[model samples]
Target: MGQAGGGASQAQEPTGLNKLQHIRRRCTCLLPLAGWLMTCAVHAQSAPTQSDFGGAGLLQTPTARMADEGEVAFTASRTSPYTRYNFTLQPLPWLESAFRYLNIANVPYGIVPNSNSQSYKDKSIDVKVRLWPETHYLPAFSVGIRDLGGTGLFSSEYVVGNKRFGSMDASLGLAWGYMGNRGDIANPLDVLSDKFKIRPGGFSGTGGNFNTSHYFRGRPAFFGGISYQTAWQPLILKLEYEGNNYKHEPFKNNQPQRTPINVGAVYRLNRGVDLSLALERGRVAMFGFTLHTNLAESPGPTKLLDPPPPVRTQTPPTQTPQQVDWSAVSTELRSNAGIEVSKITRRGREVLVTGEQQRYFYPAKALGRTARVLDNQLGADIDWYTVVATREGMPIVATSVHRQRFDDLLDYNIDLSTFRRSVEQDTPLPQREEVLYRATPKKFDGGFSLGFSESLGGPDAFVLYQVSADYDANYHFTPNLWWSGGFSANLLNNYDKFKYDAPSNLPRVRTYVREYLTSSRITMPTFQLTTSRQLGTDLYGLAYAGMLESMYGGVGGEVLYRPMGERWAIGADVNWVKQRGFDQDFSFRQYHVATGQVTGYFNLGYKDVTLALSAGRYLAGDWGTTIDVSREFRNGVRMGAYATFTNVSAAQFGEGSFDKGIYISIPFDLMLPSSHVRSANIMWQPLLRDGGARLNKRYTLYDLTSDRDSDLFQDNLQQITE
Candidate 1:
């Protein structure tokens, strides 16, 4: 990271002249080529390594495991040398994305009067879709796109790789991009009249013009590399070669640009933790640390069985040894032949009773039936036995029998009140009342922001103003989902004016009429019920639907991936908005718009010298797009540049007329000592050229965290959820 020091000086100027002069004095050479060579050299030397300041996690393990049996991994770094930190989240098995913030500290203010006042602004976001996974010798592949904020469209790589051999793995990649026809010029004349054209000897309409489109078309770039991961060690080494070709009129000088070779290494400590370092000339030596936590672990594993052990038992015993009945004892000695039977033994003697009739003896049979009944009720097999002895001390006889049955014996008479009480006591109780207090006033969470821009080029200078805002909130009536509501508004106003000088030194015809001053705005209020489920660690999939403006509503879904670390996030939303048109000329249209954004932020250094950047791009209806980059310096100093482009071909706006412009601003924090005070920032915004009428720059001071009564503060307070 670069240190913050000194005001605007000769050393800070970005020019080929200074670079050439420095090189010529040191080594005999012209400056432009030398500067280009120096840039490449710097890039080569400062290439990312596992141990560089922000190169951590260069060779980390896969973020998520495969449900089937395959592995996928992805890693990325910012393209600019000034970038300080980059991070990504890949919670889903198939998707990957990242966000990066570059540190361009101390961009000089007052460069073009009101134009260069903004301070500290840098940001970028990237998203990649894996198209194929490696199988055997085949390599994995992916298609990705990056939004460098104001820098324009950056396509991503299609990677192919081979299995690691010893300490080495080889890979190849290809990328392509179409740079948006957008840029800022130091001098307005370069983009104005033919006299100031870039090609001095060329005919009319040969060079720069504000209205003339400079589409870059699509340009392909290629890169290849060989990386080595040492066996049984934590070290990984890599070398890469990359080049690109731009096929566009605006970037004619950058055709066949060859990037310097990069060399770096990564060190891994565990599955989701690693350290990295990298170096590139003119860029800072970067070092970074990364730790990934799986969200799948949050909910824990699932259980397949409920109400565990069922009750059952063996049959009960049915019989026991018995003695003969006294009344029947006299009949047991009789034989079937009608003769009286008599027996005598040493252990027993025959029994005789008066007035007894002769009868044969038979064992009692009721014991067996009782035993069978007991076995059937108890679901168990049981044995029954019976024994009889004579009254005169004769020997006894015994018999045993077994019984079995299949039946439920145990009664399920559980106490419901007792079970309910146990559950109520064990489960955690939710907070009945939550104290809500204001934690210092904050900026607006959602509101309309109006901005105006002027075109300094051409015989005509034009001014444009834009207003955009969105209101969103959620109410949780249940623990699982929420009632979501949102409102959006957008407006744009454009005015054109121009003045030219004639050849005779007299004032040329001045056209002051507003050539095509138009404005359009839309207001939409929506209500939806949303429910989301965890798809991975820090990742979720949500579906929602409800009435919109009391007219129409349609179902939609979205996927959001937030890495364990808060530095980066990516999401995709698809909605089918339906509305019936009004009977009059101004009627509503039913349509659907898909939108997605990847966002991220990171600190460049420690303490008062730190720099931070945040970047993002939004894709919406009719290919409408917005890019923002912001950088902040220590002591609350910040600078930012933003560009918004819209191709409203599908809307009422025709193809020939579209809206596009850029806004740059610098803001500084002014702290004061007071009990109810926090901090405040002052912003400087200048209109480059306002419809042939240039106005003085404007400076505004506002509370950093707005006061309770402030519009920003009220908006944020209402957005708060309990």
Candidate 2:
């Protein structure tokens, strides 16, 4: 017994010392390189540097600096243990947020063998708030947290700063948790609590908590670095020293470091692209690149449009003229206002223009502009301009504006605060023989789009991608109701490599993605006839049926109450869906469920912050609540994060602990010279767990009537001057 005990003790010591623990926490690749190029974490109220991201120093470390407003950055870098993809955005001068996917190459997400040797991709969120702005005499400073959720692999906190002098930038900071493993220092947080004296090895609870007790405790450490601009302005040299000794690196793998100093250099490859290489820990060779742009400053080719009739300022003509050329007026409406008039009639002193809105995103702006077009053409006898907007054949609310008030508001001759109160809604009058002008309604419209489709962070495969082409079309039956559909054909894909059923206790509602990706070479992702209406002043309703998404066919209806020019709204939605077959064609699966939600939306109106919350029964039969908050920028770039918690415990939900994600939604018009009504939403969810999953409803009333809030018009009032 003594001999066996001696052997066990000897074997257990090394195993405990070198245990790899990142798989349970969150995973991170500490692959920063040669010269420490710790630039500002967020780009706001500042200019970018060579080390905007992925520089010669610690890749994950950040400095007390910021990018200019509306800056968006994409970064990719790699080391032995982890390859990281980072999407960073600067919403304000003092705040920065980022979404990270750390592809841990060494560990398999699942235990059993699969054809694809995929890595465990863990998702993380990062944020840095500037405590003080940089000045010529003082260094800028910031505080930040990493891996606030998802496994806690690389969870850490730090306070850092940056100072610039001529051609060189210097950064320094103190770190705790995963970062403070190097130089042992006094535990400053120990004064607050004895429990904080020694850091806990593994988190006892699920991820996403603040983990405040462990912060700034344990062994503290100091890390700092510097970068120098060389004689060649395009070349930057880097040098950095870190506090981490790598003695307790998660997973029992203590990377050996021959020297404490790291060195590297960066070469500017192009205007907004950078290439970096570094010698890390005097051993590993690290490399990566970054693509960055300031959306507010992007010099994309402008979309040309005919200027609005040179902002006509002429007085209205005075006459009850029957000989006026109405055909010319219709042509002008199409070119300038994008309104297809079904009919125009005069009832007393009011002129009613009935048709579908074709161009503008909201009827308010379109009405305001169309009012100017009429003012230039109509006789001064017309006093009231009534616009009856419709989507299908059904009528939305009719907005009537006193002609003089509309002109004054358009020309800035009247204050918006007062002119807004002058508009009123009236019930639509019946069509009569008095119809003076009429035009044929457009029945059909279509467009073609092609792009690469991809899914990431799945157990079946870290990533799966396909080149796809989609032919999209819409048939307008009247004005407000339309049938929309898209046919997609796969040009190329490697989804055949996918084959795995992740071990889980919950129902495999999402694990069949691989089968779907492989089975469908050509698919109809969406085919639905949607009808919508403004039910009342603040109430709206919509109903849709047919294939809603790639994986489900459903019929659903939604109702919402959103007051005009208000910052908060409440809504409800319900759907009954039948699972679609793996082929993605019009077929059915055995699984089906009814799902719904009572949701609330609040625009905090502080730095463009918006909060969205929902409670309901999910598609997987789990009851839960979801909270989503976002920050939007002046340039229309939005970055946000969301979390969903169901009654199902972490053990039942499996790997990700819970459902969470980060997203960035950006308007395409921000980069183009002229605006288009298109925005791209990119989401990064860690796992496809069957918990807290909602039905993919095609349309939500809140998204459709976004114009009811006055912010959009107020923010871009210059567009109305035309």
Candidate 3:
């Protein structure tokens, strides 16, 4: 026995050690995972944390916390390389204030000096207050002020809005700001005496003490607008008018004041993001991002007081001690039966009327009781004639006659009861059957396109052909969010044959420039993760981050506000994009610009025809520092005219002078039904030159090519060309 016990003890020793080793390995593997899960749990819990009422209530409507209800919320966002901080406070149920700050350090600087200047800073501060809550016939109202502080200039605006119908909201507002206008004079001698003029107040007759002095003033401006919102999608349409007038003292020139009418539309691509286009004096396009925080909880429905209970009473028997009919008791009973029957009939009618009145007054509580009484009364009237019969010697007979003249009364009640039952059961016949119509989903939206663009009087002109195919799919992972992706490929061919005559008056020769004839094919595969939410009836906001090929990555946000019933809307957006290049052969570099735009749109209807106008400005970018206007027909089909005017200098080939132009474009959409194909649009743009000394003198062929020749010959050539 001792020997066996010794062997067993030895066997159990290794088993114990093996078990310990297994447990240790498991702990080693699971420790880090558990820690990671705990970290994630903490972040998830902390990220969307909310305060109740007065910093202690659950966050509800993002705008609510901004209004008074003693609710306050804080939300933060990061789009790597940029971080934003948002804070909201609610002092009243109808009032709110939101503050936002955005900072980016990797903003791109382009080839031009000011095109991508390091000092290109952008910032805005806005405050909004609700004026009135919604009413049955009146719209909700609100007012706001926006202060835009940026690199070049600063401006402020006051805005007002009204909610219309049950789901639409509209707004109108005015703004005024000062823009610095500096002149470029090659020779100061032209404006100075002996190149050193010192006027009484200053060298330039301005009230400054120095020669190189600065003059500044704020120009008065005003604008009015209206807008609408819809629920089908986050769609906002807006229309407005903006104008300003100013004068330059030293130049003694009056700037052409603009009274630009504008229209625009914005569709939320997702929560925190949107796509927008507008036309004013020129065309403005924008992609933006937005962040929202609920400041208070939305109020629940109002409560109503309960109705008073009904009073109850008993009626004493009306019949009193009267003459006894003992001799003919049976006959008397029969005669009296008729009076009883009549009394029952009158009581039943009174009961029905009382029940109906109760139902009308307290529908919820009385409906069931009324139904039960009606059923009981109906049953009593139907069976009132029931009686027992005795068989006579030869045949069945009414032995005692039952002495109940109430039989006729019962029969009459039964007949009336049947009629009433039929009447009650009969309802209005349905005129039509209900139908459910479902929209069919499209799978592919792909096509090839061709386009031609030219400058009427510039050295560059091109006829381009492009073949492209696109596919877009939206997958819903939840009720309020979707994941969308699209792919497209485009091939471009440029024709650049030019005919020019030599200065010696030789015959014109046709030559093709290699740089102009270069063709490129670009394939863009795009993907996006988006989330969207409805603000109220017609207001919504979206935020999105997307990638287009390996070169372009973008993040932005947008907001749309549409009043319930109108066809106008207002939208605003802010966005940032970073585009990288792969190589010289495939790279086209542009300045990294952060832009904000506020647009308004109007839809004028005439039978089947609709006309639209849009206007807005690119608030931060140097490329589109102008007002854009366009008139669209048939929802972007057919021909439309557009114009763009800018104060920024043009591209180098145009001698870097300020540029402006108007053009007419014809757009056609081709739709096919065989595949998942939606539609494709082809646009043809014919240039229209603006007639002005500045534009005409800026890029004259002689001026561009003049440095290669003598001044006298250049002037002669310029005269001949003109």
Candidate 4:
């Protein structure tokens, strides 16, 4: 007996000092992996630096290099009379786009008719595309247009090439327009057309139209630069020879230049920030900083707040359905699996769970965790687990998984492909099963948020902003019905400075923004009763009534037909809305219109690009079509641009000519410690006009039925265990 006891003690798992030694061994094995990851991080930081004008470049000139796809950066720079604020996004590996607001300190916004003498501001868009990547003996080449859609003041186009040798990077380019003011060489495209020799004079009409006629016109100039990365990882030194002389500056505001040579230095403040200082034209001192992050590479922080999956040492003895405590199992599903259990039922050897996932972004992960919870609570007779994922009260999809296959996957006895083969997704069955438990949902939901509104490049000021405290609430009448409302109180604002009103030939549907901002200290932005229903196997319907937005109040309904697991969907909406008074009260204005749209959404399946086309009637009673294109990143960051063209002419639409804007949506889970399905949206509209204005509906059927799509689950299958 003593000899047997010694053998058992020796065979026991490691503990105390033995456990420490075992941990040390495992850590030792991971050393190489950790070193490799660290090396990769160091290499990632060596990517092309963002220039003062934004995008990958040196100083004011661009390079052929591109930032990683899905990277976003905000850059601000000041050089004497010009202060530039630029927002850039790399939507594709070979494409970079930038939107900029140029503030000229020396120029007045306008004369008497304008509200104030605030510095003149001009907005411009730029785009660059890579022609080819660099090889061992060749340089990377790219073509680009600067100040694409705006006044032709700083308009220019160029083709650039970049080559890297060890720590040194070199770039060379030929530019026209503002950058080619030197007029060193005759227009290269003059052979194709004499129009390329003499660029059009003066500004574009009202400013938003793409003046493609001015592109690549006039004489060209040569520009080149070299940037050296020093031994110190945080610093880079630059030297550039600019193509433009300062004589042809915007508004004929000439500047003196002693030399075309420009020298600069960029210092890394941290992983996501860079500070740069430059001496351009040998006459002006410039400073800028860039804040950037790779949305595709950012996985966010670990979810420390999430509950861990239950671990089983060995398969527990199965109990019969009658012997199980269904209430306890439901509670565990809610707490551990992030599922709001509506009801639990059983059919033969399968357990059916009908619920909504309120906490997880991916339903597959929620379903995976649900299976683990059921495996621990249910009887051995259960060979299958089916979860009916619901939105509101409508069943959206039913995913069924084989219990044995799932277990085999967890145990590494079967691969994901093998396990996936055992899983099935389809519409929920119409038949009823024996109910084991049903839950009662809470009745009220509400929250407070800090609200901010801003109007940029306005004549009254460079930026007019309002800060408000918003309180929103929802009362659930039933599983599928809710009454929602929100109110805002002025916390702090500079709306008193909002005195300018944009003139519109069409009905003043949207240009009345100035009045709305200055007339109210407290406002009710929304008060609506909303409900949804599943109309068919792949169709959903939504209806809402009451105050739809701060400026409009009425009723609207939307219907969407989205086949499950498909890449395309179509939706239509119609609304009858009346303009609200400037005070944001219940009083209505004389303007009322019926507006509707038939929108088609297509997922191109290339780089996760999505296109949306809407043919609709605007708030101003004009007919038009809106084109919206967007791309999604791996970490749920989405960037999109949209433009609206209506029957109203450009002159009738006022300053911006038409309506256009860009938006970025970032998932909250990417910034917070907890898991979340909600995202924060940031939108930038160059100008708000009366043309092509659509009603800001509170909800849409497509968004509500997002969980019905299976692409998100399939793309993130590995996260199931997590």
Per-model TM-score on C-alpha atoms: 0.30, 0.81, 0.27, 0.91
RMSD of each: 31.0, 10.1, 34.7, 12.8
Top lDDT: which candidate number?
4
TM-score of 3: 0.27
lDDT of 3 by residue, 504-598 (tens): 11111101112222332433334555656545444556666665222334666666664433445566556565443432133434634454445
lDDT tens string, model 2, 485-523?
Answer: 788777877667555555567766665655666687788
The CA lDDT at 287 in model 4 is 93
lDDT of 3: 0.27
Model 4 Cα lDDT, one tens digit per residue, 200-258? 87887488778878888888999989999999989999999989898878888899999
Question: Quick one: how many clashes does candidate 1 have?
Answer: 41
Better of 3 and 4 by lDDT: 4
Instruction: Indicate whether candidate 3 or candidate 4 has the larger TM-score.
Output: 4
Candidates' C-alpha lDDT = 0.29, 0.64, 0.27, 0.77
Which one is best on TM-score? Answer: 4
**lDDT score of residue 17 within candidate 2:** 11
